[model samples]
Target: MGIATVNPATGETLKIFEPLSAEEIEVKLALGEATFKQYRKISLEQRSQWLKAAADILERDQRKFGEIMTLEMGKPIKSAIAEVNKCALVCRYYADHAADFLKDVPVTTDGSRSFIRYQPMGIILAVMPWNYPFWQVFRFAAPALMAGNVGILKHASNVPQSALAIEAILTEAGFPAGAFQTLLIGASQVESIMKDDRVKAATLTGSEPAGASLAATAGKQIKKTVLELGGSDPFIVLESADIEAAATTAVTARLLNNGQSCIAAKRFILVESVADRFEQLLVEKFQALKVGDPMLEDTDIGPLATPSMLLEISQQVQETVTKGGKILTGGQVISDRPGNFYPPTILTDIPVDSPGYSDEFFGPVALLFRVKDIDEAIELANSTIFGLGASGWTNDPAQQERLIEEIEAGCVFINGMVKSDPRLPFGGIKRSGYGRELSIQGMQEFLNVKTVWIK
Candidate 1:
């Protein structure tokens, strides 16, 4: 199948491109390796300058780039614009702080002057997802490039245009010719690229299967890999939570990115004392959401990125209902729509053993559960095999501290929504995948942490 832009809103194909042949792929690999030789020798200051320039380009052309993102994957035009701005923020952040983050740290060992040095690890293969197309790639690109490591981006096939656009941005920003290049290849082609001797390490932000495949391949080759995969994050609202605020934020968090984000609140765990009120408020908020064309200014939710996503989400809903779950609203697909649009769905009384309980609802669906107390809330939240992120809403200081200490996720939010930021580490625990992204931990993910000893 050729890589094509199929507008998820109307299911129309706008453009297509054939995958690169073996010879072409080899040539690009060679270029990436060659680029790294000279690129890694550059100073952090020089790399930062180029990175900031890329950020400038992103800001200058945010509208155009944002439109491309919306057209390709069906995110709201407004959110797409925000995604672009966020990408720029990450770029500028790394550009300004990379020198400090990657600085050599002196160690007083053996009474001699020795220090640990941070270095780049040749060419990094980035296998990224399409959910937040630009943000995902830039988060990796900003830090990897700033560390003097060349990157070969094998972005999700559906977002080919975004991939090429990013490559263009880096080049125009004064990066060396092959410092960052988009490989217009298929998933079947990724392993061979990873096996290449010149490709030092890899990073992936995608599904569990994709992460497993890449991690296994990188392992067999004895190369390092960082995987940020799926999440079925819990959004816990205790009795002491600001019920109105928690309910409002819950709707926005669940419906974010049309519910395609890995970090979007998937499970709602409400304490029993206030569960009735919380559920009532949540239903009102969900019903009031405006789902329509993503390009429209007032649209609150957009279609799933692809038809397959719609089908998967619908199936999850059906399975949950069959297993004795109660649908409070939006149990069916929207009628008379050309795109993959599913109404925002809310299911309550879903059995803990139901399929939906363990599955990651990939679209705009929220699973509600009521627990007797904070301890039970924590129990239900930690039941999932995936632990990418979690959010807890409560005014009790002791409860908030306990939740933070007990929640099984890479990142935890107390009385607030969970979001990825350039200033904090983001990733997951358990089967959600290993390694962190964003912040100081993110920048260090693909770096060479070398320790020096003098005797």
Candidate 2:
């Protein structure tokens, strides 16, 4: 097998796969371009119908699909199922709103009749990551396909089964043979795929380096690219916030996806007045979490997706400790387990110049920061290169308003956790990457907004 699946939960090489050869890749390129020609012509009503059918398939066998994700990437079985359901939600959302979102917008021009038509730009290459594997792909696929643009997915090598499963769903939903396809390829093969003249645009959700590589290659060709990269989102808790609620939610925010999530709240910024209480509550929550087999129904945190990820996280924690950061709760690996497991750890006394201060700790480790006031809290929140999302906890109306306006992130949640919603535009600024991925704006990313004038 050129492309294969490995069980992350047990550290077992369950299967191996061979990547697609150049010749096979060429056939897929031809197939996608040719299929898109007819697929784009299909009416929006028909496309919506097919997308809904795909959603139905996902919802009906969500547990089955969830198991594949869990087996591949080590997400807890419950969260894996939720990811499947969320994929269906995005598909249904795009299916229901694509028509309205893409309808012609009349232009005020010299011509008697002029409007902007959002027409599909043909084949798109999607390089999706393994975290929330199903959700990430579907969010892009739902909008891209609903807008009449065909997609070819080059999903993470570890989740090839999930990738193929997605293609199967689209086919079972009656999409044409090549309307949506999964290419079993590697990173070295992506640039060549994007080089195809028939491939109109490309989108990626992964690390900063990967995004830069794809964006650079696609830029040379002048093809459009949307990159959603890594994030070290700030979870700010002001003195006025509900300390109990904020602390409780902080645990979930940091440990989400076993802290593998790009949008996970790595920095916990608490105002000095409430720092001690928040830290105490948060530590309690973290320690109480059940860390074990992802297949277990009640496990709060699962193993990191891979051994390297586990080691990287452990090193980050130790570096923080070496640089004067104090561990308030758990630290180090849980060696008793077979899979890649790490204890939920919290750190404090980390100065601004500390190595951990600006790094995105992509694990179940939290770096705590104590702020003097609203001004300092806002400054600490925007300190990192990542501006993907932020959660500002405050009860004061004026403070909420300030946080909402001053936070340098694409999406901000006041008194709540930061997350992606199918209805809202999702993306980031600075090093976090650009381009929206959901809602009305997402559907237009790969479309030709042509101006039609009838004088």
- Report lDDT per candidate: 0.91, 0.90
Q: What is the C-alpha RMSD of each candidate to the true structure, in Å?
A: 1.0, 1.1
- Angstrom error of the Cα, residue 62, model 1: value is 0.7
lDDT of 2 by residue, 1-455 (tens): 34668776688888787899999999988999889989888998999899999999999999999999999999899999998899889999998898899999998889999999989999999999988889999999999999999999999998999999999999999999999999999899999888889998999999999999999999999999999999989999988899999988898899888888888888988889999999889988898999988988999888888888988888877887887889888887888868899989998998666657988888899989987999998988888899999998988999999989999998999888988999999999999999999999988899999989998
Candidate 1 lDDT by residue in tens digits, 101-182: 9999998877567898998888999999999999999999999999989999999988999999999999999999889999
Candidate 2's TM-score = 0.98
Candidate 1, clashing residue pairs?
Answer: none
> Considering only N, C-alpha and C atoms within 3 Å, which residue pairs clash in candidate 2?
1-17, 1-18, 2-17, 2-18, 2-19, 3-17, 3-18, 4-17
Q: TM per model?
A: 0.98, 0.98
Badly placed stretches (over 4 Å) of model 1 are none
- Candidate 1 local Cα displacement, residue 281, angstroms: 1.1
lDDT of 1 at 13: 91
